[model samples]
Target: MGTNICVTFFAFLCLIALSNAQTQFLRWCVISEAEQKKCQDLKKVAASMYANRVPSYEVIPLIECVLGKDVYNCMEKIQDNDADIMALDTGQAYFGGRYYNMMPFLAEKYSPGGAGTGTGDGMNYYAVIVAKRGSQFNVFQLQDKRACFPGVGTAAGWLYPIGEFVKKNGQTNIMQVTECNAIVKTATNFFKSMCLPGALTSFYNPFGNNPARICELCSGFLEKKCSTDDPFAGYDGAFKCMSEDAGDVAFLRHDTVAQMAMNSSYMPDNYELLCPNGMRVPVTDYMTCNYGSIPANTVMTSSLKTKPEVDVYKNFLLKAAQWFGPSGQYRNQFDMFSSQPWGYFNRRNLLFTDSTQTLVDVGEKNTYYSWVDNDFYQIMEYHNACPLITARLCVISKQEKKKCEKMMMAFNAKDLRPSLDCIKGKGTDDCMKLISKGDADMVMLDPGDVYLAGKKYGLEPFVVEDYGNMNASVHVVAVARKRDHYMTLFNLKKKRACLPGIGRGDGWIIPMNIFIETEQFIPQHCTLFENLGQLFIHSCIPGAMDKDYNPNQKPVSLCEGCAAGGFRKCQRTSEDQYFSSSGAFRCLTEKGGDIAFVKHLTVRGNTDGRRQSYWARNRRSDDYELMCKDGRRTHIDDWENCHLGQIPASAMVTAKYKSEQDRTIFWQLLNYGQQFFSSDIEGDFHLFDSGTWYNDLIFSDDAVRLMRLDKSMQDYRNYLGQDFINKVENLHKYTCVPVKPSKKSSSSHTSISLLLLAAIFILQLVV
Candidate 1:
């Protein structure tokens, strides 16, 4: 027996020695057999391309696994401590809950050694609270309160949630530290144990019998009927339960259904639509979001240097998940989708989750803040606990991921563009194409990036008009939110102030001091003047945009302007009121009024006043007033329905009076040469639609000089101040009238020379 023992001991010692000196073994930590097989396959690929560096770039894929067999063994031998660079997450939505946002923050903060400052991987996660079946606390109630998290090391479980908590506190000035502890170790472990392999699952397994058990722990009680919301929230609970029994709640969960349900449903559609002339139509998919926007597209950290490197790193990240189990299951099944759901996996993938709730809750201090803000700032602040990326836009692509890397690699290499791109899908696809060509000037674009990219490259972004949400954009154009803001700070050579014409509306809206200062809004100003008379005609067009206007008016005859849109009756005085009118001035149509500004009409036998400005001789009587048809006179019945005697809804009035009448009455006063006024245009308000506040309306420099408003400018100083208006005055007063478009002085000599040349050519051909 003694001799056998000695032999066994000696053999064991040899085995121990063998384990210590081997150089080829990789410290892999896969827990499952399937995962182990995957790791084995990865090993073969690694050997074939170990430390492989592609042309024009240098990148290596590093992978390892942690096996529970020996907790410390896997970490014992890290082949390279931190020689090169590394990226932890794929930055895909599939893993966004664990990466994106926090990664950037960590990267921005850390300024790591060889990687320089801000080098590290990223992580994404939900701020979850795994509570018991029944607890008495709602999410909002827990604000600034203590909470538990999985761990702080990874971006998913710890950093993002902590950051969210800080963002909620309004300022990072005094956020309390979170108390995260291991489930198996802390009192909170009760919630963890329920979801573990033990008891068929917990009251909160999301699939268990009494879901209230889990909800109570996290949300206090479950009202049976749908009170309003839930992550997977219902109307309400069958009943409430005690607090301590409340297990936990995953406040900011993974790609889990519970975490995403609220955000997806919180907002309805985004646009207020209308058909031309107030026509009725079904408008879905109009605008589906506001105070909301799509998440970031792509991001990069110090993880890779070239596009290929980024691709490789992303692939490695996929491989990392191979250890979880069957691509779905895990040692902890509750966390399964923390890796899959669509919101976490969309192309522009999100960076954080709990931040969504944070945004909504902190509305008091920071209205309109998005989960994106905290996400971006976290990446900026952290620099990188590991290695992070710096992306001009929040979204990034692995393919071009390494492009930034290459830039950093060559000291002399220059970047004429930013490392990011963003875009908005507004109106038509043709507009999207404009982004590539740099046409639209989006106000939402990050000015920092605009300056960087604009200065780098010789490119610029210009404005294009035609579409925008009417509520905001009335003037100049806006660009793709993702496009660079090259010109915002560069001071556009202010175009000369344009005089208010038939095209410029009610002058401009008086300064919008009431609704303009809340958020970081873009200059939604416009330059393409919507004619003043046109605005009235356009807005009052019956049946056009009726659904959009939902106007409240009792249609009275003013023959002046529509009564909706804050255009109610003005009280000029008690004696001279239409709807109890109060003005000394009564609106009247010049002989040029009611013209077919949009169409031309012919003389088809009119014995009425019959001169100019009238067309469609139908229903018009010889004694009725006349109006212009495209600046030419035409006979017509009274323009106001009151005078025309209200034609039957079933009958076309034009046909009743005269068979050929298709004329519709649209009125306007003629304001051709009025200084600071248009007979065609009413109201002395500044135009906000085109952001021409004091600059263009009332007085163009040329108009002022011609009207001599320049000397008179002082007279109108109280009304038209000199701020941005000076640029308008200087340009317009001195600017030359557009050179006449007529053909240059005709050259009879040139014509004769041409004829001679023709003759010579003919002779040459004959020869």
Candidate 2:
């Protein structure tokens, strides 16, 4: 019995020892040989403290070092479970968390007096521009000046300070600088020379296109130049560049100058902070004279760790700080805050920033997006902007222009590319002219205008609007009141008709082509307004009086049924009560027209309480009927078989000279815009909804989505189909006429002709 008890106790003791060893094991990733040496020494110091029963050392974990090629490699190792922890700058921490699924648990804090004193909030530091006290220039004069930066992608060194410069120089469109190399190009264009460490390495300058002047002020030689190994590569290096007169200004953290001055001959009073307003103040007033604040470096670990596991890591860091920090009793044996003793004299920050005093819990701001300031994160996003071209969209009316501008701002805010620009024109024809002249890029047009644009101005359709069905066409129907039995497709002469507009596909072109094909109406002259005037006793053809579409004799009957009071009469806009498919239906319902020409959805959209206009109140879809081409009347829902013609839907048209790539880019722009700003989204702007007053602004309000057309359907004729094109061509052959010159051009021509006649008469008299 005595032997059994002794053996059981020994087994229990061995199990306890094994459990402790397993629970205390921690592997830390290091990026440099110096960091690895420092990490090993830290392991020895931690073991010694625990064995000696140093105060608050019970939580210390057994440390092991893992070497990595760089911070990115370290992040990958931690994610893959090959390592457990690493210290990273806030910018690098963001990359790790966003790309490697790591999380930050602790942040480094600095003291106001200098490093090694543990005081400030430990969450944020200010970015500032430092220069000699009596420098002759201000912030605005930094163009073509020598500058120094810690390294590429560092918050205080590149993002915050460069963001301020971009703002001050009115580079709001700098979102166009989408890549790291593009950002370097922008910097090169603005600065005469710079010392941007790590800017020319294979990681940042993969194409070997970065300018050499970006590294002219760096102190490293040969392959180490402009790399992290460069002696001038951190906060201290940037300051040294300025102190040695290698650069006119240095971008650094607000605490950098004060911290480095503690051991050097440089005094804080010799330098001043350059305020964004172009004023200079003493470096001590950084709070009032800095560009912006960014988060500090953080100690990060894999996000897959459990809460208890994370707690263990946090507690270990806290205990290590208590024992090895500046005020610790073991400070002389192993100072965790200094790297000079570890043979890293040329490189300042190893394992941690030399300015870090102690580690603090990150608390609830543990995620990368939450831990970093939103503005600073957005600045970083600019470096990854999509490489896309910019395209201009044309708008005709003031309301459409406002909506287009809002869309541009919203798309830019989301960083969607290709970026959009809004160009305002007087009318649809003007927009077409603008696009043809290359002043604008694209516009939305109905089938009638699409044909005109293609046949007259050399434009093609690249994208088509989809209205929920695979068929990219709508039924053009002649709608009439069920009580009006006399209004058939074979209507007698001297009847009134309402048309959406002069050039609209469903409202005017299709209906007029049907009339000509059936021989119900005869064209006495090439002038459509006169022929239509003689056929119908009175008509509501909106835009009939507009000189751009007519430019002929004034027809009183065309505008007689229009409801607008003044100059807005017969205008092709929302101001005219009779201007679109819905407006034409309203004209037939209340404006004393016998027949209404519109698309199939006009009745369903405005009737049944779908529309809230006062004119459409108490209207029901059952009250309307469709006029079929076979001289038969049917219910409104029978438009699929009882319509005059089916025409293609509206499309986005651009100059035919635009390459396939250009067309694809335009399609992508609209496709992306609708994804975020579509009617289904709760965003502030709706891409498909026109306000209460307008029917369709830049695009059709009924469209649910935009789709890119197949390569074979890029041409307008092929997209509209040969049969529809033939019908339209037949109608246009009799109605279309050469546009007369404007009055000013005619007068100029007359004056030139008179001058030539007088010159000839004088020559004849001399002979």
lDDT of 1 by residue, 274-318 (tens): 221222221121122111112321222222234454345444433
- List the global CA lDDT of all models: 0.23, 0.77
Q: Write the per-residue lDDT of candidate 2 for residues 534-616, one digit (tens) a residue.
A: 77898888888877567673678987888888877878766687877877898888955889998887888778887666777
Off by over 4 Å in 2: 1-294, 297-389, 612-618, 739-767
Worst 10 residues of 1 by lDDT: 647-656
Q: Count the backbone clashes (under 3 Å) in each candidate.
A: 146, 1
Best by lDDT: 2
Residue pairs that clash (backbone atoms under 3 angstroms), model 2: 198-226
